[model samples]
Target: MPSNSGRRRAGADRSPEPRRKPFWRRALRAIFVWGFALALLGAIFLGSAVYMTARELPTFADLKSSQNGQMIVVRARDGTELVSLGPSYGRWMPYGQIPQVMKDAMVSVEDRRFRQHFGVDPIGMVRSVMVRVETGRWKQGGSTITQQLARTIFLNNNRTFGRKVREGVLALALESKFSKDQILELYLNKVYFGGGAYGIDAASRKFFGHPAAGLSTPEAAIIAGLVKAPSNYSPTADVKAAIARGEVVLGVMAENGVIDPSEAAAIDLSTVKIAKEGNQNSVRYFTDWALPQLDLLLPETSEPLEVWTTLDVGMQQTATSAVKANVPGGAQGALVSMDRDGAVLAMVGGTDYVNSNYNRATNAVRQPGSAWKLFVYLAALEAGYKPDDKVHDEPVTIEGWSPHNSGGTFAGEIDVRSAFAYSKNTVAASLGNEVGFGTVAAMARRFGITTPITTVPSMVLGTSDVRLIDMTRAFAAVSAGGTSIEPYGIVKVETTGGKLLYQHRSTRGQVLVPPHVAAGITDLLQSAVAIGTGRAAQIGRPVAGKTGTTTSNKDGWFLGFSSGITTGVWMGRDDAKAVPGLQGGRAPAQAFAAFMRYAVKNRPVEKFDTELKLPEWQLEPDDEYMMGNPDDYYYVDENGNMIEPGTADGAARTGPASGPPRYEDGSEGPGTAGAPPPAASEDFLDRATGRGNQPDPGLRAAPRPGTAGPASGQRPPTVTRPPTVTRGQAAPVASRPSAAAGAPN
Candidate 1:
């Protein structure tokens, strides 16, 4: 028994205590377990984020289509680019067409390890985090080129952890789908540059006036620098800052071994020639007006568009120059010019588009003043009234409102032609009442006045507000041989790939008025410009127009046409405050003339299709009259006493007398009996038309007895009046008058 127990004990002791594991092995096993659990948890998080982001990701087709972006190039009639709406994008350059230097510059500046990373760069992320922690701010971005492309296509600009996870997952997906070169190309073409430019080609053209294929080292560096902060590094925004950023990019390129260090040091970014930026012309008014019409003309699509407009670049420049030169100081002006067929040739919405972009020519509504008389007269003519028909210019009471002439005194019975030519308020009021307010309103609407008319007696005085474009269109109807026209700027719209989207088909010569009625209206407009208030608008051609001045001189307007071109001019304070001596016949008429002079320089002179026969008495008047200015006229009363101009009594006596005044030689003259004709030196028409070299010296003659004139040693009153035909020279008389005859009109 003793022996058996000893052997068992020995066997038990020899059973070799089970080998104990080493500390390093156990530690390694513990690490493997923890690492596996951690990796599983990270996979779950990444998978959940990918699912959430992928649910809203755009399809591959959408991504491919968005590569070119959206752009609208607006070109003038002659193929000159007026403006480009939306972001400017050049033709897409394929990856192979992109220069190797451009690729190096972008890789060096944006993501140096672009080629090495699959999608997310762990080394770059760690380095960026370290830099941020050390600097207490985020200065470097950890996104690889693929990550940036993924974010641009499928993610919003967000800095949250969730967004970062989504961006990383999407980057991986994109990398799996596309090659490195494809990712780089997409990234370069989709990034924004400053000044409304997008894509490397656009940025290259916008900055260096060249394509990405032709980029030099410095130019490439500058464009590549914009990826960091487009606005801050834009050459147009800050050339010095952009150049400094480019220099930094060059340094990065040198460090990456993309370029020789000596060459990088030798490159001078200052020597880079930036393309001249497009002029920010006031033609924006035309483009703005034409853009809204595009939606109505074409189907909705994402393709880039080319809008061929009816704008004439030369005429636009001329219109702009004329408006700028004639617009009064501290006041604003707008001008619009168009063909008889309604093709808009030029438009100037404001004196300076940089200072103010409010389009007065197309948007602003104001009193048309006497220019509104066009509709009134048209209605009258339609009512079977002839230009030679007589209309009383005496004061008339309508609905407790006593309408008086602008001159305050009423001219006695006169032909409708004379009544309109003088712009007699009483005459217009009487005609409005005679023709019926409804008829006048209907007439205005027929001619394209879209604004609501009050139908009150004062409506004839242009008391209603109306847009300048509408009024201009109405007059265009007259110039189109009485045809209705819709004013338009866009002629055709198509894609850059030659796909036709929209094309304007002219509807000109749609007769809106009877030939006789249009002829009568043209006769009146001709008379107004030839011998009436609108004489300042005459350009030594067969031109017709009307002048308009609102109450208190708040708005001035001139609408005229010649050689199939109709133009309208407006001048006033934006606040509707009265400007001292502002009148439609002054600045507005002058601007109209200045613009028309150049507009019709090459066009052949044309006459009205029909002529109105007038009475011999109306054509050859016996009275002699002298107008100091468009606003002032001197007349000798029956008692041989001179009447002061602008007074109510003086305005009443403005027109020709019923009979000729006898002279000392028993020959009839324009003035009272025995009063000689005004001195030939008093060329009021020349001075008003700006044909004379020097400014008017003022009234030089002494005042007649019982009438007051500028006192001795005092500055003479400057005389300004519409052009007048010599007495008995077969004067042309028609219709519409100027109330503020003291003004240049």
Candidate 2:
């Protein structure tokens, strides 16, 4: 073989002679492969960037101002606004208003390396990775202060891969354009503290009732800790938890030299002081009025906007004070006061708006017990019945039921005026039966008592449920001479800078009885205040109203109206549990009295004009039109016996009370002289004692359809003569008359 150099030269010559491939061709092939791979990666990156940046852009307001927000003042009058601040300012605060110490604490706790590495802290990422490796768990995060700031200001609002990449990019861009301080300031001012607070300033004020700059070291630490979780570690919630979190923050601050160990230890950890029950909002009750107004004013899905209510702060305070003082202990209370035009002036839904959102004035629906009688009386008046109309006060039964007075004793006889002032259940029920339940329900709707009026005999006795505001407005209608106007809270909704976004125009109309008829009812209602169930609500002012107390005392309500103010009050438990021994004449009446005493203290006391002052309730001969016992109100036509409408009621046809029959068996019976009623129902032994297959009328087969005989008679069941064989009750069914003939109880 040749030498190495000689062999290479000979090999080169031989290869060239054999038509060697072109150098550019191989280079082009390699370049093409590299370009293809790089292009593929570039496309992937471009697609990712485009997708991330293309997320739907939010409107200017949608992100910054959407909230279930309303402005309200519990008290207001004449067009003047008292508690003016409502939903506005993006977060209810400005950046300059924030405290420096709070900002410092946040910086120390959230991102200590905020000053270094642009937006994304490189050191933090490295440290987190190291910790994760050392701890064998992913317990740390790589997000920098700038990333969090971007999330607060504007970001994907999501936790997806695309959002994360975009967040990273935005953070880097922000750091490039803005200083670390600017981003940090923005974060501090824009973050939410949850309970309706958007920034540190608002959070501090809402929790401590003071500016954030006023916070002490421990307070600042607690606030800083709240940055991670507001509602959870709120000092107002769990004091121990808040202190524990504050201590953790103090440790961090000490570790970072933000504070010395001695200084940290000196910090007081005496928890944040809130209202104890709930957030202290000035326009609490006005919220009840404004919310409905907003729904009507705003479009179904309009841009975010704030609703400024026309609530007077002083009035609201007075109303709350009144409720607090007059409401029975262990009983929840609510009050509503409005101006002549139905503008809400003062309201206290409950003891605290923050702890409970029940909104008794607006949302609570309790039985209007006797107050419901107002509508029935109004119906009767509208149907040509007079206040002096003679009504019966004797035992009478409906289809199968009968009503009794509150004291379980008849008044012997009385007129509509006397019956109304006393809130007689039997009298009110009689009025309902006469006017018809449907008519009463319809009339109630006109006065803003829009809830359904159930169909039942006792329903006429005010067994219907109605809200405080609704009842208040209904009574307000009576005060306004039957002009029904819907209650309103917001006079107009405006922007933070005073731009009028919406202006409400509320008008009153007539939905039921004429104004004159309403006047008659008003006369009696005023009498109730003078001397009746509503005596507690008497303000020495000429006013008209009704007092309501439900069975078992579940609710107490007083709806009354004066010349300048129309108010309603309710007292009960949040759980709807019956308040032992509480009635409308007590707590609710007292609450109404207190509110009216303060609210109308400076107003004039005016007298109302009564349509009819005649005492036409003179003793009249028996007639069918009389209220209670038809026989007492009606008589025969002349000839031995004859009648038209009188016969329609079988009770009136029954002859004079027949003395107990002279039994051939000489056995005693019920209703006999000096003897009590047959012990059939009272004595369980009569039912339990086995008297050898004696036919227990209760056990007798129920009536078959269409046939009418003593056996299986076509009559309904009842309380006094309930089927003993069935369950729950025992009575001598054999001697009991048909339930359809009359009410058992």
Candidate 3:
């Protein structure tokens, strides 16, 4: 409001007196701003210098494509390649060769400023900082393609200011070192797509089974979105979220003018491409077990290598489905399958490998129970007892220790066929004693029983321990006719360039049983499936198997074989706790049944062994072999003829209609011996009557062989004529036990 004249005077007066904010003040501000800018620029330059140099550090392999430019072909046993893995070069092209749709998709999803920035966008950093500042926390990165490439090829895993600075410097260096096109090409080719895949090419092939260059609009968008966070965009690991991310990326590409708005709108984001196959076909257990066995030959320690194994992808699928169907829910189990020569064809450790770490097939060692009877009976057969031979069901004791049948009862008397077919515990126990605990133990060892065994009489009852892998291999020995072989997983390893570096094949050795004997045993095991405890395992084709259930029903196991494959299954609680009333004939046998059902479904059905037969036996009881009080019945006779009618101390040896033989001639015959004269010694009578170790009054001669076994699924009880028995002594039975209701028939 004062006048212009006054204002002019005031201005003139001020101008002349002061340059108060003189040279020093102005100079300070200029220096401060320029100094800060120079320092920032300098820091970036120093970091870029350090990072670009890091690329030449030979550190590329760490994050580079595994198999490093190589492709691994997983082949089935029959030489069928199941999968081919490598870069998807055809489906994926450099950023230049990509369709505008793909470019837009990538630009929209990753960094809209990708085209304008000098390898990075400071704007992105500032925005990221703003976001973090608003949230009062830092949770994001502002990495550009160049920065990612530098990190991929050189940097260790660290998230810090120094690392980011280095990243920017390296990005700029890379831009200087290579053309933008080349840098983009490498970046597209080097990004990881989660699931052990690297580069768009590999990822495309892994996800789509095609080259990346051929990617469709939606596919391109999805893959482009993955560039932002490959794992986050993984459809295999998570599909809904991945698809949502792709849509957002397409929008960005349209906004950035990388693609036409209409094209961006047409890009599909409703669904994502899914993996054609799971990495291991869901048979994690078998694969894991096979992994260690691979070291047997490849020795990963010797050199970096791969081994080509004989796994059949189809068979693996079969095994996985079978496990899920057969093994009880909330229950865990393991299955191991192998070829006759011990080449592991398929293995599955548990129902859901992603959720379970327990490997019931190999890691868990549970009792095989009646399954152990196979070994017991085999030992008997090896000891010269025929499958049809007779064995006493009378009470027997080994060092005052009595072994009871699984159901805690005796069959009174039976032949080996009845004993095995019915899974009678008493006869098995008797055969175990006769075969000698050493014999059964030896047989198990030859078949690769890794667990230690005690020579307790119970060993005759299959009390030893074994793993599923070893059990399958041992059972395979039976199928292969006595050739013991090792199981292996890896088959051959080659460089991505096709240079063979390692290979593995099974090694075989002749074990204890003869081929014929093994074949014979297999024949009986087939009966076990067809007419015995393993009835559930009787597949459409010929199968031989044995089922075992542990005491208290804690564990269940089944071992069986077809012409081409042998498998073992174990079911139990992880903590070694009882599973209530679970038994071998339940879960394990069922799993075996389920596995064979599919394993043989699409494959050729073959007979177990074309050349095996059950042999006949003739029984003759051995009195000396009686389990208790060996001297209660036999003594020297006056005539030294060992007469049945003779007695000790000049008294006649006899019982009331117990046996009726007072032969003047030494000819042999069978039946209830006609009661002989009473033995002179009432002491023998007292011993017989006291505990009545004497044969049960209910004991009687059984019908002859041809008359008995054919009636029931079981063999006849045996009653054999003893060798010149005086009053009390009988010789060991010959060949096999006789079939009879109460005697060797």
Q: For every model shown, what is its TM-score relative to the native structure?
A: 0.60, 0.62, 0.53
lDDT of 3 at 66: 27
* Top candidate when judged by lDDT against the true structure: 1
| Residue runs of model 2 more than 4 Å from their true location after superposition | 1-81, 84-144, 155-169, 175-182, 194-217, 229-268, 271-282, 291-317, 352-358, 493-501, 597-605, 609-745
Winning model by TM-score: 2
Q: Number of clashes in every candidate structure?
A: 20, 15, 58
Ranking by lDDT: 1, 2, 3
lDDT of 2 at 490: 68
Q: Write the per-residue lDDT of candidate 1 for residues 1-745, one digit (tens) a residue.
A: 5798898988888856689999999999999999999999998987676666656566654665675446889899989887877787777777899989999999998898988997899999999999999999999899888877877776777889988887889987676666788788777788777777878898988888877778898998999898888878889767899999999999999999999999999999999987866666788888878899987898889898999999998788777877876677888999988998899999999987745768999899989888999999988776555565556655566665666664354445565666666577776776777668898999998888888899977899899999888988888889887889888888888999989988889754667766667877887888776666775676767888888888888988999899999999999999999877777777788778767767787788887664422222222111111122332332223332333445635244366432223122223456445332331123432433224243222212223345554333433232121122232343223342222221111
- Cα lDDT of candidate 3 equals 0.61
- Candidate 2 Cα deviation (angstroms), residue 283: 3.7
RMSD after Cα superposition, model 2: 16.9
TM-score attained by model 3: 0.53
